[model samples]
Target: MGALMLKEIRSFLNSITGYLVIVVYLLINSFLLWMFPGVFNILEGSYASIDSLFLVSPWVFMFLIPAITMRMFADEKKAGTMELLLTRPVTDMQIVLSKFSAGFILVLFSILPTLIYYVSVYQLGNPVGNIDNGGAFGSYIGLLFLGASYVSIGVFASSLTENQIVAFLIGVFLCLFMYIGFEQMSELNLFGNADLFILSMGISEHYTSMSRGVLDSRDMLYFISLIVFFSLATRLVIQSRKW
Candidate 1:
């Protein structure tokens, strides 16, 4: 499992695609945080916070993660490498796990560079380091969970199809739905008491909650369950090849 994990990690890092994903994610966020003259801009606000980056990155990962992981299993199957992998001593679950870990790590790496934003904000605080350290720290944790969940969805989507593009599209739409669809559903008055409950079920709700420096157990469970569910789905999808 560790060996497969390393190989998958190496393949992503060795290829231009990995760097491209990181670069694009960073570039987009940097532009929005620094250059864009919109509501999210810090310059327009009275304080300096990386709140903008965190807010927008969830949406960004909705697309970037899928694009990055779409090929993990899809290309392997398309190139006949998946069968070759199966011939080894690894089980379908291990293969899925290895790829999932690799993809999630890559996604984590892509977000880590944004820590510079955190440091800068801390230093730039009027009273120097007056920023909400707790909130910022919690927000970072929330971001990691969000990225991890997104990567799992990517792995699951990739396992379902040999066409990488289709995998990417499927992953993006599914993630978007989980991230916002439930929350949006709550906007309607139909559910009444159930409305807020359903909205809290979405990834965004939990993510936003954690961003406020409140580490709720329910939120953590939501994140873990998401990762596990998608990983299990990916394993099953690959096992179906035997049928």
Candidate 2:
């Protein structure tokens, strides 16, 4: 499992495509938080917090993670290497997890550099560290889980298709739907006072709760469940190749 995971990581880092994904993610977020002259600009915002980073990152990740994982299983199947991989002495679950971990780590790499934003905000605070450290920390954690969930979804989408473009499109659609579509539906009064319950089924409600520094276990569990569900779904897809 570890070897498979390492290979997946190497496949990304040793290639231009991986570097492009990381660079593009950083460039866009950096421009929005630091360079752009608008509401997203930290310096122009009313408060000296990194709220803009948190606000913009989720949307950016919706597209970025799909790009990273689009070729995970899709390329393997496209090049006809998936059969060789499956014949190896590893369970379907391990293969699924290895790919998921590699993709999740790539997301983490994209996010880690943003700590600079946190430090810059800290210093730029009213009294030089007067910012809400707890909230910022919580939001970072929320972002990590959110990205992990997206990775799982991306892996599942890749497993379902041999075409990278199709995988990418499916990933983006699923992530966008789970992140916002459910919440929007719940707001239409369609559930008849079960609106909050329906909204809770989506990622936005829990993500919003955690971003506020609340750190509820329910939110954490929701993310974990989503990751597990998608990972298992990927494993099942891989297993289906045997039949």
Best by TM-score: 2
Worst 10 residues of 1 by lDDT: 39-48
Q: Can you write out model 1's per-residue Cα lDDT over 140-232, one digit (the tens) per residue?
A: 889999999999999999988899999999999999999999988999888989998999879989999998888889999999999999889
Off by over 4 Å in 2: none
TM-score of 1: 0.96
Q: Backbone clash tally for model 1?
A: 0
lDDT of 2 by residue, 55-150 (tens): 888899999999999999999999999999999999899899999999998899999999999998899888899799999999999999999999
Go through the candidates in order and give the C-alpha RMSD of each one to the true structure.
Answer: 1.3, 1.0
Q: How far off is model 2, as Cα RMSD? A: 1.0
lDDT of 2 at 91: 86
Tell me each candidate's TM-score: 0.96, 0.97
